[model samples]
Target: MKLGRLNHIGVATPSIADSIRYYREVMGATEITEPFDLPEQGVKVCFVSTPGETGVNEALHSALNGTQIELIEPLNSESPIAGFLAKNPAGGQHHLCYEVPDIAAARAWFEGLGKRILGSTRIGAHGTPIFFLHPKDMMGQLTEIMETPKAGH
Candidate 1:
């Protein structure tokens, strides 16, 4: 049940393209991944990498480096985040992902403490097994628990 590093910050967006442009033009983000669709999750996904974290040495960190921003857009009306987009219109931060050494152990620990799990563990954007803790049980914020990524991933 050991928690690893903060993996990423999930953001719901009306359009990944627009989000990418803003991140690049407004924030000077230079490392953005090409947007891809995850039909199984009903969303288009892209990652925005951040550098220049305070007190952090870039040479010491790997590719995952600082926490990333996951820009997510509904791929269809059935997308899980569609309702969020409808309410937000402008979209906003969606969830926070944290890495865990073992998905099963983390899940069991949370369950033992009476926290509600959102769904069955599934493959996440990072290609690692992940599960969500219900917002109601996690301080009104959806929290994603993901398996720690392998080196050089």
Candidate 2:
């Protein structure tokens, strides 16, 4: 299966608002999307577009190669990321999401290799099908595989 692109870096936070402030004031990131709840996932999510990667042409970087930082906050105590926040109250990087042409194929390939998939494919924040690969099988990082968005979103 072909890996498409690095979609976003998931960051688990106690407060998405606070994280937005830090990203704006400290990191000087200004393209943060509004935080929205994903009840099915028991979390609130926002995306921060990051520019200025070293060695990349700024024009092309902003136009086509920019990356996103997804800030995720638990909706309630029962949220899945609640435990992660409990372990690190300050919040931190949670997972890495990668784009794939076909999530179904990616899932089958991983399963064929005997890797554990966290759950059945579900609609993700990007409005695309996604699935998570267990950290143990993926070098200690929770990996999200998402189907590439259709043209025009």
Candidate 3:
């Protein structure tokens, strides 16, 4: 199967507001979008984009010029970010999502290799079909495979 572009890098944080401030004030990055809550995912997310080397936040921002940095703050203890933070108190990179042409084929390929899946495939907020490959199968990184919605239904 063919690999697609890196969609976004998910960063787990204890407080979305704090992180937002850091990215905005300290880093001097412009907000690409406001923070929005995704109850289904049990987290609040915000996107920020900057021009070039202005501060610490913009430093990492340049590396992800074409992509986005998804700052995710867990809403409750049951959230995945909470679990990740429990293990890594300072928070950490949660997962990486990749746009794909065929999520089914990607899933099948991983399964064929005797890999375990964290959960069954499901449609995301934007109607994109997505699935997560167990971290064990990917050297400690949770890999998400996503496909765009079809023309009709």
Candidate 4:
């Protein structure tokens, strides 16, 4: 499997609005987009860009060079983010998403090593196909493998 790059760092928060303010005002980070509800994932998320003093719209669309910090607040108790927050009340880093050239190949590689997957491959909140490898099988951290869309696709 050809691993592409570090896609984004997912942060599970109790409140999306509060998290956005914390990242923008306190951390001096730029808000890339307003909080968008992902019904499929049962959470509201806001992407914040890493660089630049002023928040620009282009930052949200450009995924190649910039790194995005994803703030996720679950809408329901059954949501994965909510489950994570329930486990850790303080709300911390949830998962790290890495871009891969082929999700099938990546999944096969991990399964070949006898690692357990949290679930089957599914479309992620960001519209990328993704799957999570169980933390118990990993080094005490849940790892996400995602396949980003091609230029024309």
What's each prediction's clash count?
0, 0, 0, 0
lDDT of 2 by residue, 1-153 (tens): 876678899999999999999999999997999999999999999999977566768665543465699999999999989999999999999999999988889999999999999989999999999999999999999999999889875
> Candidate 1 — which pairs collide?
none
lDDT of 4 by residue, 29-141 (tens): 75568888888779888888775334547644454555678888998998988888989886889988888888898999999999998878998866778999988887888
Best by lDDT: 2
On lDDT, the stronger of 1 and 2 is 2
Candidate 2's error at 12, in angstroms? 0.2
Runs in model 2 deviating more than 4 A are 52-64
Report the C-alpha lDDT of model 3 over 22-124, residue by residue, as the tens digit: 8778887675567788898788887665443345586465544546677888889999888989998887688887878888888898788888888889876
Model 4, position 15: C-alpha lDDT score: 89
TM-score ranking from best to worst? 2, 1, 4, 3
The global C-alpha lDDT for each of the candidates, from Candidate 1 onward, is 0.90, 0.91, 0.77, 0.81
- TM-scores, all candidates, are 0.91, 0.92, 0.78, 0.84
Weakest ten-residue segment in model 4 by summed lDDT:
52-61
State the lDDT at 95 in candidate 1.
Answer: 99
RMSD of 2: 2.4
